[model samples]
Target: RVRNAERCARFATRSSTRVKHEGAVSTVQVSVLLPECSSAPSHLDSVLNNFSSFYLIKKLPVYELLDRHFLETAVYHGAVFGLSYRTRIDEDNCVALMPNGHLTLSLDKDSFEILGFEGKPSRFKHRTATRFVVSVDLTDSSMAPGRRSYLRLLTSLKSRLQLQTDFLLSHHPGGGASIQPLLSRCDWSQHRPEVNCRVLTNLPCPAPLSCDPHSFLEWLGAVDAGISCENSSSSFLSSFVCPEPNTMHRHALSVSVSGLLLPHDIHRLLQELRRYVEQPRLASWVSMTVRGFADSPVSCSNHEHGFLRGGENFYTLMMFHDHTYQLHLAMGAHDVCPP
Candidate 1:
């Protein structure tokens, strides 16, 4: 019997809205709402310094994915990281391999069937058999060197269309240097995640303790997008305003890091944000957001992530000084509710 079967809540076990419906949204939004706690954990700065670094793989081959040496070093270390840089359109062919060693390939019908691996038809905007997904576990024992499954995929990637594309790769603990072998085979460049910080003056902030997660996140999104929130409902341009029961922050700090960010680093950032709220300061709260890779093979956990018009899978955490927090995890329609 499933443990805690009787204790399961309707929210966790119920059929998810994401799975049953199709929309412009195709992501898994699962937030872990946390109760207020008292203190912050230490060792934040050290963790931040060790965040994974991103790299560029120019003209990387599909068969090189089976490189035993590179796999043994980086992938085996549990630092899976790879994704195609997305343009405004035609990003459907994008490939993303998460640190969990899941390689997700978005393909057309010909490529999907020709590659001939186990994959499912895409759920987004696909009334016909147009798009497909091939999600393979690179770390699986069956995928080991020279195995039947491994060779088949290698042959498909090598002898088929001979696919090669630009990829952004990252590694944790060892950083990008760990994957140098793969980079040596092609034109590649290394990059670190860009961090930007700013201080806003006279900012309208929803009450840290009172605001709902969805509305608060919306407000934060507006801030990030630099849209004027003073508009009224009748305003033709935009109608976004602060949530009710709000407060004013004469001074607020905003820091953003962008790149192929890994989850391990995000967890460290969360720990640091909690500490910021614990300190005695004018600000009563601190908010943080972690956006998932749109082309991520797995969303929330192992569940498949799909993309439509908007592959929005992300969560915003509002942590109040009282140790209470509201986490809003949002996903698009082509995913299960996030865990």
Candidate 2:
């Protein structure tokens, strides 16, 4: 869907809010395209370089996430993004701590029974129902320290199940300071977001708004991967070609950032991109794409995520020079509707 970004002041604010809501949740990678630029501005570079660092806690106990200090300092005060590393959602038990202070667990029937928590069968269950989902709001009154539900879950994870796994965690507003207490208790390492850039020369491109959605995404993916689309149907490898009514851009910039990205940082990057496009420039449009983690148990909010044929969930935002934008949110066949 496309919206005139500056048609009205109030509507612009609402659109900005929607962008933050839809594009920021559990992003695994972000890619940006500037069709006519050879280099990025220093300020933009700074923003991209300064994305918050995240921590990897090795073999951390699942019950530790409910620590009073960690919750009071990080989860309650600001958003904290966490996920179990190297754990497959469909096979092994997977855990996710969302920004809204909710802890979600996707478990098999055996593990779910062992955990002994109140939960519902997974919506993705087939005829037999082998999976279950347990979601708990950490900020709820019943989850407060010394409460009945809080103690029961803590004991269940600590004494009964004793679940432990490698965890990836990060917090906004406080960053390392907020999560240091949790890190101090376990073996951990901190790392920054990885950034990559490529300069394309004489690249074929289609009209941003006029091209078909699937075809445009195909062309964009080819460009991002440096694939040659000059094949014919009779060719053996790939019969991909740039869509018709396309132009050859003399220079274009492709930049990407990958990590356990937070929504706040992405929102800042969008503001910078908007500022960059608003200035007098040769290119009339630019595009940003965000991809969610493939194995995540939840996509936008609490929407269940599953892998049927390569569990893909993502969105692309195309901002034009005239303060208008197009948003395309997509999911795999087995996934639920995106927010």
Candidate 3:
């Protein structure tokens, strides 16, 4: 999981692609941890401040996404990340717009019946088959504006289902320009990714690379949540403690961004993190965790995502001072393996 500093660029390139894939589906939150650091550098702060802004369309009609002009200008130009806001994966119907111009609908049996689209049953484990997944590739020849499949979906959504929900949407390469046509038609508001920073003093932490995966993640999670890890194993309130061979860092920095985040923004952040490490510094490592939208219809690389239990889909990347890196990708029981 670790690579030499010399191969950091190559490694970063590969990893950035992976993160982009995940982000393309939907990213709600990204958290970064810098142990033994008191403050963020100017460049790093700039990257954090400049994360892309996304739009929230209030009660956007599902068929509007299929509009000929909107598709040509935005979705086709580059990846457009869209998700049905406030929709719960386990209960309510959900929609996802993938980077490859695919529109996915996770619907319950009744909803699927009403929508009347050709789709497969849900892949996640369920006591009974009560859900279905309808995926339409907008770029397919058959889905061309006047084609049968295109009209079929357009009719189903526009007339039959009349699906309208608050939508969170963002695009790369084109940003607002590409999506302007779509946004102009809806009641929408633009929002920048919200950034939060925290400085911790005398924090107990384990050596990230040397600690066991489970233990280190547990410790890191505790730290991120501002939980006290100074507990005995037998303590009833909380048994969590810094792993052995740990050191007390005089100070550490934690920064997080929450919103409809894009891959381009994340890649830039990673580059800044690498740049931070390349400089002469006391900290030997930094960690970043990107969490996908729990209700997304797809996870990394367009894998079918479900919420059978936890609905967890996320990855944690740990970069060391030597340019070596470790990546841990995980998904919930309802999803396939992460890429």
Task: Please give each candidate's TM-score.
Answer: 0.80, 0.92, 0.91
lDDT of 2 by residue, 18-120 (tens): 3444644678889999999999999898988888888889999999999999899888975689998888877888999998899999999998999899999
CA RMSD, predictions in order = 8.1, 5.3, 5.6
Q: lDDT tens digits, residues 219-282, model 3?
A: 8778888899878999989887789888888999999999988877888899889888777777
lDDT values for all models? 0.63, 0.83, 0.82
Off by more than 4 A, model 2: 1-21
lDDT (10s digit) by residue, model 1, range 1-339: 221111111121222212111121112121221212222224543544445666788878867877888778777776657777652112446576666677778777787778887788765534587777788888899998889998888888889757777877767665556677788888988777665545566777777446655676677887776666887889998888899887666665555666777666676566666666677766666666667666664566666666655656676666666666555567766566644
Q: Which candidate, 2 or 3, has the higher lDDT?
A: 2
Model 1 residue 219 lDDT score: 79
Candidate 3 differs from the real structure by a C-alpha RMSD in angstroms, to one decimal, of: 5.6
Worst 10 residues of 1 by lDDT: 3-12
Report the number of backbone clashes for model 3: 0
